[model samples]
Target: MRMIQRRIRERGEREIPARLIGELVMEALRDLDPVAYVRFASVYRRFEDVDAFSVEIARMKEAEVPGGGDDPNRGD
Candidate 1:
């Protein structure tokens, strides 16, 4: 990604933090593709178990819709 590279260059730091790079990549991925975002998050977050992945997926699903996402009380 040229954007990521430009960002790192703008920082003007000899050593860049991995977390910053990961965050930039995540932002780009989120706008470009949902699946890619999740994939990158899994590795960037270093998910150790299924629960972690489940939690991340749930978060994304919730954010995808308004009104706090789908709910039984909403009567979909």
Candidate 2:
């Protein structure tokens, strides 16, 4: 919601594009929780198979945040 609010403020409360709103919501979910992000991304991006899930997860693993993001597959 903060993202949307910020965009609204930036745009002087003008009509925001649905695509931008969706992207912001997805971004907020990603920052809040990986599982949630994946869940939303799957639906939003219309993921159709395990391959899509794997790809999104792999992309997340690669973009791991600093001082966090332990490898889920490495048994850390």
Candidate 3:
């Protein structure tokens, strides 16, 4: 939770909205564990159907590859 706390501190605000906390959690989870990220996102985003889950999975898969646009250190 330190990372999330640091994110809030970095924002330099006394109060942060729930959305921002969720965003921080999503980002940290995505980088730390994709599977866990998807699980959390499914609940956090409140996916109504399987199509939404499929789309998120596809997006995460794309991000896993080099130069898929989520990384800046590719080919280094």
lDDT of 1 by residue, 37-68 (tens): 98899988999999998888888777767877
- What would the per-residue lDDT of candidate 2 be over residues 1-76, giving only the tens digit for each residue? 8766786678775577877778888888887899999999999899999999999997787677453566566553
TM-score of each: 0.70, 0.75, 0.82
Writing each residue's lDDT as its tens digit, candidate 3 over 1-76 gives 7999987999998889999899999999999999999999999999999999999988887787776756655452
Supply the TM-score for candidate 3. Answer: 0.82
What is the lDDT of every predicted structure here? 0.87, 0.82, 0.89
Q: Name the runs in model 2 displaced over 4 angstroms.
A: 65-76
- Model with the higher lDDT, candidate 1 or 3: 3
Which candidate's lDDT is highest?
3
